[model samples]
Target: MLLSVFSCNSEPSIQDQMVDNPGDDGQNENPDEGEELSYKEKAFATYEMIQQLYKKGDLYKENFPEQNGDREYSYLWPYVGMLTAGNVLYELGYDREILDKQFTGLEEYYDNRDYLPTYQAYPVSGGATDHYYDDSAIVAMELINAYELTNESFYLERAKTVTDFIMSGEDSRMGGGLYWFEGQSDNCTNGPNCMKAANTSAYAAYVTSKMYQLTNNEAYLTFAKRVYEWTYTTLRDPSDNLYWNDINIGSEQINTTKWTYNAAMMIMSAVNLYEISDDQEYLDEAVTTARSAHSKFTKVTNGRIFYPPNDSWFNVELLTAYIQLSQYDSKTKDYVEVFKDNMDYAWENARNNEGQFYEDWSGNNEGRFYWLLHQAALVEAFGRIAIYENQ
Candidate 1:
């Protein structure tokens, strides 16, 4: 039986959160001036830049020029993205001290609300923030990856704890899919307004499947299959073979807008189910989604393959799914190579003066404020490719 780490309630020191980058001038630099850095080195450089610019103690700021002065710390989503990159680099033998330091920062958001412990979207320092099921699910997935790479029981235990929180979001609503937000009284009662998003429920299924892989727990496997089926049946768009954004359980209205991460989670969840169940149908579904997502989300810009502008973190998730399925489908390898080329192009063209990435990967748009997750996404992308090339 695994126990969760006790939650800390003490206020963080003001002095600790006030650490800002002193030398940052916030100007664009010549891309050619950089010495030829490997993908791994570039990843390291980007990760270090995140620490320098965004690290307010252990947590990060939401934006480069923060939207709000008082609320300086980032929400759970960006922090999760930063940790996602850290875990990726850690797998490639990055600095253990730095990796552990960044990961430990998760404690800031750890909330034990009435003994139903899980992470909230905002740091606990600001009081109890909204607990999004998707945020906790992603955090658990990252922790699971950390545990797999290091064989650390602590990461695994924390992942299980978060998984418990994720499972709490699942109710009989929508014929059985997890609600997007926790503690919402209208989650089940509010017709047409209750959102059980693909991002939340699909990712929860992926995390559950991974937990099953780590523990061989039949209960986890049962939950994974059920949730995966619910998400697929509820959110997938038949025309494109990709997933829709979410569904309104009350009205049964599906949001047809497509996002890269939505389909990517379905692909990954399908792959996990296929491996665990040895089902050809699951593998076939994974392959079909992989091809469809690759064609839909990416395009050729100036002879380089590029992701859609903005949402770097979403593309990172999509790229991860592609890599996971590449073992069975050789075409996925080609998909990743194109993304690698795009990263190289962004390195040369899309960087700002502070070495942070712009929302636009096409190098056409340069902005004043760089997002924390955008920068973190680059590190994750490069680190993944470096790991893949080595393998």
Candidate 2:
């Protein structure tokens, strides 16, 4: 019983854009000045938030609530929110006890036997007709992360189940991208053209590379390479180095509207492909895309990336891209530092007094849970950077 709270049509209040000071000069303010906070401090803060939301056997109750005689659970947003939080915990060196608890809650919701409407108001609600390809793929990515942290075959097995379902023979038309929902006979006949489709493919590629690293499985490597080729060739805008959000397979027109997350996914996919293959082409693609995105969206003021116009989720994704590229190319140090500066800016300017981020720093609040999920990802990215610096 998932409640469908469809607030997508409403515009965000003007207060959402109310920042205290947009002209603050924090870039030259000394990186070591801010309380000397370690990654552990940030990770623990995020972990405590998770624990407060999910405790005892009452985790499912929070996920599926019955308020005012009506079921009040959003299908996709809550699930993705939990998955993002779980990944942050995993990256912060949390134990399997927490992982098991989170995984159990996700599995229960996904495994519900009752039938419901497929196209509910919720974005990722699952039902007889609903086939949430991207949301399910995100869950798979989280499971894969859990497997990496816990060495648990169960997590890997669950991830494989999700992959198999999406990769089934039903999705042969859209060049391997996942559909948003089921039974669309129009432009989405093959699948939804959302950027999440590309993101899912990229996640699969990354997971496959990791699996190959662990098992030396040539099959996984081959699959990874194939998916990488498809995504880069199809979704990538070679001219602008940015990716479109959707593609109309029927009209053959690329969804020219660019998004920060799509660019981040392209960066991640290119980096993983380069690592697995050690091919200069892949590395060049990654570098080219990163530099292009930086030039287009980021400006350096006081030696820091300043006032980037995009979503907060891209802040973390861009950081991860910078870190990965820096491993192969030391010249990315300057860019990586810029990324850190931008992240600090986000912490100061984007977050509300309640420590929550709006959907878009540019003042678009669709009321989706993706903004919160992005905040969790930022915590994970910072934690990883902290660990790397310490090492």
Best by lDDT: 1
Runs in model 2 deviating more than 4 A are 1-36, 50-71, 112-129, 169-176, 182-197, 214-219, 299-304, 307-310, 348-350, 358-371
Inter-residue clash pairs, candidate 1: 27-353, 28-353, 192-250
TM-score of 2: 0.72
Candidate 2 residue lDDT tens string, 1-391: 1123323332222122212222221122222335545666655564465444423352422221122322334344344555656665556666646566666656544643243211222422333224444455556667777777778798787666665554431244567654343334123433223222455556556656656665576877787777767777777887877665555556655655555555666677677767767788988887887777777777655445553554455466666667777877787667777666655554444544334433333322322222234445555656656655762
For model 2, state the Cα shift of residue 54 in Å.
8.4
Model 1 segments beyond 4 Å from truth?
1-34, 68-70, 185-188, 191-193, 367-369
RMSD of 2: 7.1
Cα lDDT of candidate 2 equals: 0.53
- Indicate the worst ten consecutive residues by lDDT in candidate 1: 1-10
